[model samples]
Structures are given as structure tokens and as C-alpha cells.
Target: MQEYPNYQDIVLVGGGHTHAIVLQMWAMNPLPGARLTLVSPQVQTAYSGMLPGLVAGHYRLDETHIDLVRLCRAAGARFVQACAHHIDPLKRRVSLLGRPDLEYDILSLDVGATPARDLPGSELAIPIKPIGHFHRYWLQLQKRVQKTRAPMKLGVVGGGAGGCELAMAMAHALEEQVYSGRVQIHLIHAGDKVPEGYPLLARRLVARELEKLGVSLHRHWPVAAITEQGVRSASGATLALDQVLLCTNACAPPWLAAAGLALDTQGFVLVDEQLRAQGCDNVFAAGDVASFAAHPLPKAGVYAVRQGPVLFHNLRAALTGSAPKSFRPQKHFLSLLSCGDKRAVAVRNGVAAVGGALWRWKNHIDRGFMRRFSELPIAMDETPAKRPREIVAARGGVSLSAMRCNGCGAKVGAEVLHRALEKLPAQQSAYLLRGAGDDAAVMELPQGKLLVQSSDQLRAPVGDPWLFGRLAALHALSDLFAMHARPVTAQALVTLPLATAEITQRDLQQLLAGAVYELNRHQCALSGGHTAEGAEMQLGLTVNGLADPDQLLEKSGARAGDCLILSKPLGIGTILAAEGMGEAQGRWLQKAVEAMLQSNAAAADLFAQHGARALTDITGFGLLGHLLEMLDGGEQLGAALIAEQLPLIPGAAQCVERGWLSSLQPQNAAAYAYVDNPQEWQKLPQWELLADPQTCGGLLAAVPAEYAENCLQALRQAGCTQAAIIGVVTGAERPLAPVHLLRKADWRELIAREAETVQS
Candidate 1:
């Protein structure tokens, strides 16, 4: 079976190669009755095979990294971008940083070795093990160098393969990027040879290449401490340096030392040949984080790549109650080492070769490996259709869709609702006189305040019910927030897929619990609503709010010359649509999720305080449609938008460039019919984005030109990082029409021509 309402949980703790391969394989062949979840702190995992190429500027960021979010989407797994802080074997729980703990029936660890070893003064220098952090540091370093454009000196503490490659790459790139500034690089090695464990010939070739690239190499110089002045060597010699990086030996993450798993001398998990933890039946580990008890091997990605098939086989065996297979270390494997330029050294079985041809071959091999991740795509699905074996047996082997009941019989049991509500934290409310137990909730409005109500629904965008519930709840409450109303109470309307009793109970518990978590934050009480078993999982909310009539904002009172301000970035719809098709990168989805989770309440308050003339929330209608609504169908008013001024989500531009748009995008584009020469404007990259629908998007407001700058600052102070002034309104001429998109150059040219006409 390819799908099931999971009866067992399988959690993977890292986004390394082993787990990535396992996910792709799972998509091809899935194990029934098991749910897959990946907990990783990063959405993108760097491929070590192409790290040298990336440093050399031969490959782009996307080429050298795997998108974990897309991989999880392809595998039908729930992805949680968080670090695992601790593991409790007895309780079968994994504690996470900044979120709730996860319970697992089976757990796999592939969190690669950490480079933050017990080196003295290591904090003074950047450690290069966590690739994500290193990549960020690398980007910042480039910007700093470009900005200052001054003579600089850089040092690498350990002359391992990583150190040598980066030193050479930096020297070569600086010479090209900042020709005016002289840059010197130094490679200091504690060992006699660069990359101590490698062959002598390979070491000699790497040294020759480093010399050709003008990278100075120092052998047998172990740094004792890093000081403000420079790196102090064991021989009492100090080398002055502007920046230092540590490519030191790798060790297990510090948190693993306290975990209850058996570990080796270096704190790595001890596992059998089958990749299963020693003396543990339900836990397994792979990659550099695990040490095979049968034999010792150097930390390499190839070993993890080799372990993928065995790990997959053993995991399925464990879940299905069958025999498992063991993994064997390859006796001889080829090694490719790249120089800063387009040249590499290949070594195998006492023979070594070096040249640009070797580099091309290495590039081909690396890209081939990465293509496996990019090529896998999945079909969009609303929900898992299959049920556990027990459910099938109980229902006479009929599918859940065929066996589902109708009307009253389909309603969730009252006992289940009572049980789910009991776990919720208390929320005291003065507005709600009665809730839950009666046929209807009775509420009272505050004295002299106007009542505001809005309702919204969304199908499951993610497999994680808890997260989906929170997003859905926020999305529903956005309407009231846009109108400057204070949320007071909410009624949930939930539709859950038919499943076993236990599965249904778990779903409701997680879903409602997440919804209440947000409601409690907003001081809104969850009064009650309805739930029914349906074909798919969905969430809706009917929110009631309170607002002073004089202070309320609306979408119809816009005057000419008003400045248009958007509180949040665009691209939520594009990323979600691409993610559903398994075509989006994990980093893109990360930004989309962050934008969706933001609340527009603060922005609304700022808009009202700054004298906003018109207000609307950018939701399912997209930016253009919502803006048109704010203009009251643009009957007597017109607007001009600066394309370059629009704030966008990180990966949104790329998604639109790739034509990944939501299903509602075409309908949203209908709003552009009100504009002049809309087809000509279609060539702009921001076109599809303006038509991209959003859920829980930002507040779009028309404010006075004088308040625009002050309002923007206020929004930023309140944590609206992407807020910006997008455009202005112009209502004098019918020729101006309802809308017009002006690129920066065109806008400047138009202003020049208008100034000339005024002078005439």
C-alpha cells in the first residue's frame, strides 16, 4: 500500500544524504501504516561533493545544495525546521528547541558530525562543519570584502581538504572580484601533509595547485590559541590575520553526550552492521553521526550513500516484521579533490591524476548526484486515502470514502470533542456568556462598540495538522485585523478525513490544540462550531470582533495622491503552489511559511494611527484584486504602482519566473483588465506575483503621502521587516484608468516628461 492513516511513527532527525535518499526511495515505494517526519534546523543541506566547486564559484547555491522541503514534499513526509535538543529512549520522545516534543515509535539519526571541537579559542574563528552556517558566513565575508575594498589577510587553521580548497578559492576569487584590493591567504596545517589521511601523491598535487593559486602554505604549525592580534602557534609564533576559519577535526554534537544512547569515544552513536543502535530495538543511526561496531571507517559521504539502501531495507523490515540486511563498507573508493580553479586531483588505489579534465569529470559526477534530488516530483494530493489494516478489516475491506456516513452520522462524536477540549488551556472571556455545552454560543458586545465578523476556510496545505490548524486560524482572523478590529471570539468549522478512532482522536487533539494556542495569544475564546468526517482535512473559523465605529477602517475612502503601503512581502501563493507540485525549494517554502505566520494586527493599528484613507487585507484575491477592492472597482480613482518598490518573499521572484502560480492566479489576473495595456505589462517579472493569491497576507493601505515614511518606520519597529511604500494614487484623468505598473526607469522618465510639460 502507498498510503495509510499512520498507526506508527517514523521520525528522522537530520537532512543529510542518507535521509534524503531514503525519502526519494520512499516516494517510489512506501511502507503502509507508517508516518514519516523529518526534523532539521535547515531547509537546505549543502552537498559536500560540490562544496569545493561552490567555493570556487563554479557552481551556484542551488546547484550545490538539496532542498529539504521539496524532498519531504515528494516523500509525503512532515518537515519541521527545528533542531533536536535531546532524546529520551525510555519515553520514546525527542525534545526540540522552541517547540513541543515529538513522540516516535521508530527514530533515525543522521545529524552529521560537528566541527566545533574542543579547540582552545575556537570561538574566535568560524567553524566550517555546519554547512548552512558556513555558507552564511561565506556570503557575509564576500559582502564585507566588496564594501571595504581594502588590503586583507586570511588564515585557515587546519589544512584539511576543506581548508586547502577554500584558501585557494578565496585567493582566486578576490583577485577577480576586487582587483583593486590586494588579498593574501595562508593555509596552516598541524600535520606534515595537507589532508593527513590522503595519499602522498594527492597531497603533493594539492600543494602544487595551492602554490599556483598564490595561497601560502605552512606545514607543522598547530595554532595554540586565537587572540585579537592573531593566531598564536604552539612554537610561540603569532601570524597577524584579518579573518581566520577553522577546518578542524569533526566530533559529535555536544547535546548527544547527554542523550541516553550508547556512544563511541568521540561521542558518536554506536551502531551494529545493520545500522541499528546497539542494544536498542527501535532506534537507528547513519552518516557520520553513527559508528559501525564491526569496523571503523573515516567519515565520508560515500559511506552514508552506501548505507541508504540497507537503511531503507532494515527500516521497512522493522516496520513490517521481517528480516533485515546489514551494510558493508566498500574496500576501495575513488576520491576527487578540487583546486580553487577549474582543476582537480583524482586518486584511487595508489594512483593519482591531476588536471582540468579531472575537474570536469568531478563536476559531472557531483551534478549527477544532485540531479536525483531535483528530478523527483510528486502529484498534488488533498489527503491520504488509505486506512490501517485494522480499519479495513472492521469496515469489511471497503475504502473510507465508500464507507463514510452522511449528515448526523458523520459528525464527530460529542465525547471526542469533550476529550479534546479538556486538554486546552483556559481562556477567560467577558464577551462569551455561554459556549460549547449549549446548542449555540451566547455573546455580548462591549458598550458602544460595533460588532465585526468574518469567516474563512482552507484545505490542508501541509501534512502536519498542528501547523495547518495554526495557519488556518490566523488566516481566518486576518479579515477582522485588516478592518482595525480586536478579535474576541472564534468558532471552528473542521472537516477531517475518515480514519480509525485512535487516528481521528489524535488528529483533533493536535489540530484544535494548535488553533487554541493562537487564539489564546490574541485573547480570543474558542467558542465552538462543527466537525464532520469528509474526503479531506480542512479548517475554517468564524471570528467575531469589536471595534469603535469612529476608529474603524474601510476600503472605499481613497483620495488622489494617497501613498500605497504594503505591510508584508508577496509570494505566498506562488511558493505554496510550487510546493504542492514538489517543484519549490525548501528555502522558498521557509520564507512563505514565515510570512503566512505573521499577524497584521500591528500594521492595521499603525495604518489607522497614521490616517489611512483605505484599507484591505491581501488574501485569496492577490494584490491587484484586493487593491482594486480598496479603490471601489476603480470607478473614479486610479493608481500607479512602482514595480521595483514591491516587497517580495525570498524565493517568490524565482517561483513566478518559473511560472509556478496558484490555481486562482488566472482569476486574480482578471483584475488587471481594469488597467491600460495590461498585456504589455505582462512582460514584467512582478506581473504573475501581483496575481498570486495569499493566505494570512499583509495589510494594504492607502495613506497620506506625509504619513508614509513615519508609518513605514512604525511598522518596522513593530517587526514588519518587509513593509514598504509601493506606489501612489492619481485620479484626475480618465486616461490614467484604474491601474498602471511602471518600472523604475519608466516611472523616472514619466516624471521628467511631466516636469517639462508643467514648465511649458
Candidate 2:
């Protein structure tokens, strides 16, 4: 809890349970002058303990997860959802899979361990240790079981705890179905005992559970090779399995070994008592992925959770000028395990027992752990910490706390941008009124008396040029839909990270092609713009559309008593922020990206037909931030939103509950300072997600109250799955910063019903 005097950056590289706890501690007692950043590939971190429950249909996806985005946001850290591909120790940079390299003064890694797959033909095998991916595969197995009623044999490699759990869970799930007896379960381990590493009593308990599930167990056998048909054991025994799962012997990520870090013989990062890399003080490692020379511990969630407090302290100490603290890992921690049939067993200090109450206890503990991430409250520290020395040096001590002015200030620094744009020429247009000076250039209309225009830009957090181009193009077009302007012509401004000419060309082509695709979808002409190599990646656009002046849509057109409609769900901002940090889940990330890539043209079309009054796409700013713009344009107005009614991308609210939020989330929350009780806002996980800034987000349009239902129906029919009638505009209820906030129960019920209907 001690505050450091100098600003330093602590970059955590996973969204594991340990890091989630670390974030919570940091939120309560922040290290002054330190900027915390989390990198992960998922916005939602699955709780391993609940995997069995989830498989058994006892727990929901939202029940057993951590919101990496919300956790980072609550901790006042930047969350980047990106996978770590390599680490440059000399450069102090962590290079991502296909994004920009991240610079950190001090780094802590808790990315967890994966099952070893170095055996021949391992690619044909399934890994059960990565619970989330395995969960999806398990779902496929269910479908396969149903499709083929013939006898099917399931093989599990590695008699460890994970393998035992999966075998039991699979047996329970498959047996409950009509094809129960047709499904055969086999458990193979290199050792004689099931759950070999646990105490004798615990091992015996698991064995009994497997016996009751009618699972066949093989001992002292290792797989020599895995094939499409089956696996070959070293003992010269061949086992035919319809599905084979491997869940033994955890190994550090391959990238870590290639990154040149000092590792153990097994390839885990070697760390000292304080979790600092054995030979590198600036880098630290932990979880199942790390090996400690002084105190080696098994890869267990309990150990990871216990290490959090010590890791947080040591990380700050390493950045500032302080001695490292020792992390004394316990010799034995309690292990509460499930048997996939509402039954459980507890293993602690060599004692073991099983009972129904034990399962309840386990569920309580897991839910409690998840609740920490799901029910976080937001309270910003008024006194901002000073900038880090590196950032100060980069900025020459210039102020950077506030947003830069738009017109000239938003432009790149004079010397830097001038040289880049010099090679590019302005477009020659007879109707061009202005080129590049004011907020946006003025362009006269054609004979039809209608004009179409759009603008967009992206500050790169992660990902490569190709993906960035597509995202930028989609973002730029949001404005055209907001104004209900017809797509006609478009241009782009691309800024790329410095690289060779070959890289530049590839970047430009992909970037523009992405823009071109969207423009062409609307039949708009891709005229031209500007491109330049720079220190980082940024893309923007100035688009033009055509419409009668009288038909032009504006934020000022919202009227009192109108219904507030949101065309898409919130949470992309938080998810992307988490993705940059490498804490986001791979599946959740795919979903977020898909959502961002979708254009709002369909929703806009539906809203226009529904008597849309005013509209603006929610971006950079959050829901309340954008809503205020609509309400305050003329006479003051208030809004009563059904907190549950607001449409949100799946898992976003859970991320908020876990305290995962965008870097802009706190800022958006600050803009919500007008709200009297922010705690009330915290109850609505989705409402808290409203502060999550979106990339290519949907339009927030005001529609006539009379046509609200019809508008909603039209939107649904037009394929706007997330569209919803969130609330109604109200007269101003006294002057306050929060002119709008959520009404929890109503919103929650509506959304729950919406989810069920969609599922049905």
C-alpha cells in the first residue's frame, strides 16, 4: 500500500486469477506515480475451478469469469487485448502477435501454463488444460455424440487432476443423454494413481468417483504418438478413441523460451524468491508458467492467488528504488474439486473427503472469487499522479493530462506531419469549399442538393496494418449513418509505424482496401487521401455524403419525451483495451472484433424508417457522455434508462463486474460526475459497461415515442440483433452532471427476456 515517489509503469501480461486479485489490491491502495497496464488476449478470464460446473450445466458462463477490462479500468490501468509473441529484454519491449511493441519499465507475467505438446503428431491431439478452448471442443463432442449413436470411445491422456476432472465431467455429461452407454470413457496416466500429485486419500477419492462413472483407467503408460484414429502408448498398447484429450505436464508458452529469457530445463521462466527473473531484475514471472529456484510449487490457482499481494508489492518496488520482498509460497494449499455431478471432494494437508455440502462450499468460494471482478465500484482519485519519467522525457515535460484542442492541436505536431503530408496532394474538386484547416473542410453540394461526408481515426493499441485498416474504415462510416447521409465519396488519412518500403506498401494497400470494401458496400467512391510512415499507427478519414439540407440529421434534433434507442451493445472499448493487455479471452476477442467490423448502415436504415429525430454514433466518449450531447444541445433534458434494457455485447457486463474497463472508462465516469450515487450505477454491470468506449460502435438515435415499438421491430427485422429501446427522454430534473442513469431492475428483466427469446 506504500506509495512510490517516481512514476513508473508496471505491465502485467495476463488476465489470470492472480492478476485479477492484484488489480483489486491496486485499486484499493494504488502505487502513486505508477501507471499500471495489463496485456491479455481475452476480455473475459475463465475461472478454472468452475469449468466442471459449467460443463455439468450447474454454472453459467457469466458466473465463472473475470472481466479483465473492468478489472484494469477499476485499477486505473490501461488494458490492451493482444497476445505476447516475444519479449526483447534488451529493448525492454514486449512484441505482440501482430500489433505494436509495448515498452515497460517493469513487467510481471502470469499468462498461465499450457499442456506440453512436443510429442510426435501432437497437433492431432486436443489439449484440455486450456479450459476455455476445451469447453468449445467439448460442445462439439456433444454434437458428435448425438449425430453418431454408434459406440464411441473417449481417451484422456495424463492422469493428473485436470485429466481426471475432464474425464469425470465428460462421463457425467454424456451419460445423462440418451446415448449414455454408447459413450466409453478411458483415462490414461503415466502413473498408477488418478490425480497422482494429490494426497493418497484425495487420489483414492477421485479414483472412486471415476469408478462410479464407469471410466476405465490405465496406469504407468505414456503416449508415444497421437493419430486421427487413436493414440499409441509406449507399452505397445493401441487405444482407439473418437476424441483424445491431453491434460498433463504444464509447460510455459513457446514464445517465452524463444525470447531468450533464462529458463529451467522444463522451459519455464526462472525466477528468484521475489518472482523477479533470475538474471533480469526488470522482468518478473509467476503462475504455472514460472519456476522459482528457491521455492518450487505446483501449478495451482491457490498458489497463484496467494502470490498476488507479494507480486504487486515487488513489481512496484522494482520500478522505484526499493528492495524486493520475498514471496514465501505455502507448502500445501486447500484444493476443492468437483466431480461433474453436483458432487465434490476437498484435498488439503493430506486430508480428503467428499460430500454435497463440500460442493456447495466449493461453489460459494468460486462465486465469491468471481464476484470480486463482477461487482467493482468506481471511485476516481482526484489528485492525479505525475507522468512517468520516460513519458515526461518523451514529452519534454509538456502537459498531457487534458485532451488536446481539436482543430490545430489534434493535428500532428507541425514538423512531424508536414514532412509526411508534403508528398501527398489535395484532391481537385469543383464543389470543394475548403481543403484542410477548420474542424472539417467545407464542400459545396451537387445539383441534387445533398452532400455525404464521414470522418474517423484510430490510435493504435495493438494489431497490424491490415486489421487496423478494416477497423478504421468501419469507424469512419459510423458518422455517415449517424447523419443519415447517403454514401457517395470517401478519402483516408493513414499514419503507420516506421518500417521498410515493402511494409509501408503492404500496410497502405490493406488499409485502403478495408476502407474501399466498406465504401463500395454503400456504393461510395474511394477517391483519395494521404498516407505517411510515422512512429506509431493512426488512421482517420473525412467522408462526404449527399442529402437535402432539410433532411440532414443532427444531435440537436432530439426532443423531449422521445425514446432513446441504441442500435448496438456497449463494451468494445473495454474489450479492446483488455485485448491490448493480453488479458482478454480468445473467443471473447473474436466476438468483439466481429461486432466492431459490422457496419451500422442496416440499423440506420431501420431507424430512419422509424421516424428518427436525432442520432450520433457512440465513440471515444461513452453512452452517458454521448447522451448528454443530445440532451444538452438545446433546452435541458433528462433520461430514465432501463439499465437492463440497454443492449450490450455478450460478456461486457461481466467484464465490468470484474472491473475491466477502457482507459477512457474513468474519464467517461468522470464525465458522469453529475450522477449523485455512482454506487447505484455499479449494480448494473451492463450500465457500468456503458462507460466502455467503442470503436466502430452503433448509433444512439432518438425516435418518436409513438413509433418506438415499430422502430425496434424494424431494427430486429433488419438484422440488428443488439438493437433495444433503452429508455425515454425526460424533462430536466434539476441541473446535475448525470442527466441520465440506469434503472436497474427494469433494464435487467428486459435484457434477460431478450436473451431468452434470442436463444429460443
TM-score winner: 1
lDDT of 2: 0.72
- Please write out the lDDT profile of model 1 over residues 513-590, one tens digit for every residue: 778878888889999889998767899999999999998888888877678899999999998988988988887788
Q: lDDT of each structure?
A: 0.82, 0.72
lDDT of 2 at 281: 88
TM-score list, all predictions: 0.90, 0.63
- Model 1 TM-score, 2 decimals: 0.90
Expressed as tens digits, the lDDT of each residue in 20-97 for candidate 2 is 888988877676556678888877788888888887778777677777766765676767777998888887878877
Once fitted onto the true fold, the runs of candidate 1 whose alpha carbons sit more than 4 angstroms away are 1-4, 146-151, 175-182, 382-402, 411-426, 433-444, 500-506, 633-635, 730-737, 740-760
